[model samples]
Target: MLLGTPAAPADAAESSLFRGTRQFPETALWNDSADPAELVRSIGFGAVGATCNPVIAYTAISKHLDEWAPRIARIAAENPTWGESQIGWRAVEELSIQAAKLLEPAFQASGGRNGRLSVQTDPRLHRDADALVEQAVRFSLLAENIIVKIPATAVGIRAIEEATYRGVSINVTVSFTVPQAVQAAEAIERGLDRRAADGLPEREFGSVVTIMGGRLDDWLKQVASTQRLLIEPGYLDWAGVAALKRAYAIFQERGYRARVLSAAFRNGLQWSELLGGDLVVSPPFDWQLRINENELPVVRRIDVPVDERIIAELSKISDFCRAYEPDGMTVEEFDDFGATRATLRQFLDADAQLDALVRDILIPAP
Candidate 1:
């Protein structure tokens, strides 16, 4: 147990749908928000873990301003020398730490493999491997179950290995393709090997790699519209599903240690299609509520391959090819991928917005 962290509450009874979904131990449900209230409810639904980014942090803080606003003011006053970015990140840290406590029951029960709260490193440090490693290490220290998220870009790959070697369980984020996932996994392997060579213990490092499948779907739709391609109906929705299935297949074949986590929910297929694999499907809290309301049966469809005709059509797009095939992209090209660019921009924007939120508390408008 981590010092100063409260003991986790006893496990709540799982909802019927979530209880049924637990038939496959390999498959698990994780909440994608860091809000404690949402996480409390999600735990009742059998959510084993949670993840957070700048956007999630901003959203949670905004939603609970009555509670967080005073906290932010106190943080600002306590750290008067700190800037908005620093103060904002301090709040993010506190938010993450609080959420991590709620998962302690699962973390302890799973021996640290299942119960985790993923906190992303600063997006602006994507290019600086050293800074990314520094922040990743610091975030990992926030709590015993904290998993740090780093991007899968060129420099990020370097930092992933270094951070992993230093004993931080990493969640590879901002990745959308097979190549990014494979490369990130290989980097993790190297880090683990280095730790073993140095006689360091590798226990409790439940690392995961995230593939934002919905974002891929959105990018392909944009590509089809701009290029004026006459695409068949509903084929676009399957792009992310197809990529996720392919990535899972490869991970199974290769026996990669890091589990594949499907994120960036755009549709129900993102949840329904990727079940039954030794992977994670992290839908937002709202998405989980909707899934429960729809009463979708917990079906095992992870190995169910996408239809060949759809793959053939999607393969026509070079970007889709880059994402689908394992060798389609190199580490050098990861930073330039369309999906990578779009996600990094959004994360950076969220960072700015978080800073602005702190500014509002520190320097109010006249």
Candidate 2:
């Protein structure tokens, strides 16, 4: 408490969310078809980082192939030769680059930790291990302070190894289980060792394992009918939290630093535990907004071990299939794709800043 400071203002509390002890970075939703810079600026620069995805980026392109209108117009004015495809990729490249610039000071302060923006590879390419590695390398070329996001799939782990070997900052996304996280960590270590063997620097390589909390809940909810008979309400795996804690510890134990960033968090409950790691990435802006309304929870580290005993238990693909059966539904069970696309398109077109942002994004950064 400051002895001579004036009484706190009514909205002063909102400031806590900006620099809360918990890393409040989120899914940037770049495909919302909004000007990425305007969106980033609205979110503010401090304690702010972004998560990128192909699905969302495709969503952005479905609507944003126009001339500048809002804040992004400023960038478009400088560069008018870009086409739609270039614009789409530029939206990603630009955001990652600018987001890195936005957080450059923070990265400097943290000695290359925290203040990070995640740029993910195409999820459709999740199965091509070799291709995934190439994509990660291409995305990370000439960029610093950005984490190329990879899935924790078999192919994705292979890419993670390749990316880490190149001294690239990587954030492996869509991680759903303890073993997946552990595997990603192991792959990262292998890459670092390979780098050291080649007589290269390895300290700049960072990997973030995103444990998708809400998606698990979403997946569980999809099975609610069978779940009633097979599991309990919320029927959730509290053990997952413990699993993540253990994996994070294991990565550290192995002398590798793959940061565990809790991802797909649905609500404020995730912020309650003080899980120790380099940092944790939260999802959805609402949770961050809600955090300001309540007190920030003190996240702690749980003692869980990742050993060969557990890693071996988790490696088999057959075992995973048994745990997560894909008996959910078929394509015909959903509504028409055209109608959904039209609806989404109309909504995004309404954003005035999107066109300009796309244009400005592609111009060579000054």
Candidate 3:
């Protein structure tokens, strides 16, 4: 096959790729949705955890409006002074709390490591470390198995350390590169060190730093198109995969306790390539369905390096360089990274949409 040609899909077979992943206990599967039905299905497929962000919370509420619409209205009624944003956030909390219950068994089974419901801090608070830390601490109290998500932005790095010091297990989000992952993990370590110095009671913390590899791929693709750089489209997919593999290797070499999680998956390579590592691979419910339906082979490929030719080609992109190297980006530049800006905007838009959803119920158009 040509280097640029897309690989053929796995043939359907009785074997389940998701179930097959179970053979490698170090590699855990987490469903990327909070919708109860999807989560329930995912749990059956060896998913020990799930996540809820503004977009995911919005989707979960939208999917079960029959149950949530009245709840939203009652929340507004109870807090007469509350606006759509407050009411909407309350709904997000309730949705996350409900999802957390489903993972309790696994939470107990994994010793507080795998069965976590990751709920992200409000993106609107991205700029304020104090606010982010406050909200993350509160989210941590929602459920024993809850892991708060703070972005990998400059302020978020501060918040992650503070939140961890406050005993909030964190799942760093909106991170798309090796530098972002390592820095976020270091911040977590700092927080843990501070807590220990204070002689705080020992507790299990399931902290993870997410490398949104697919989003990195997206930004590089956009850069390529805008720059008129002639490149193999397939090579672009490897960009994120390469970044993730590098970040995982660094985490191992440096002994960073925070697990490296691969998020924003675009292709099977993101999951397949990272198999057999002690990390998390969270794919959206749809991707999980597609992989299961195809029954892709479950092979240990985390140690398998990407083709050198593809890496060399992707390195030509300046942004890919920033993502692929540890010193590629500084904490200060994280907020302005193309992928960061794009993802934050999308998350903020989803938050605004959630407010609108609550508004319609609280103040219907006459």
User: Ten residues in a row with the worst lDDT in model 2?
Assistant: 326-335
Cα lDDT tens digits for candidate 3, 15-107: 344455557778888989888788877776678888767888898898889999999998988999998999999988888898899999999
lDDT scores of the candidates, listed in order: 0.88, 0.51, 0.88
Writing each residue's lDDT as its tens digit, candidate 1 over 46-116 gives 78899999899999998888998899999989988999999999999999999999999999998988899
Error (Å) of candidate 2 at residue 216 is: 1.7
Superposing all C-alpha atoms, what RMSD in Å does each candidate have to the true structure? 4.7, 9.3, 4.8
Clashes of each: 0, 6, 0
lDDT of 3 at 151: 97
Task: Tell me how candidate 1 scores on lDDT.
Answer: 0.88
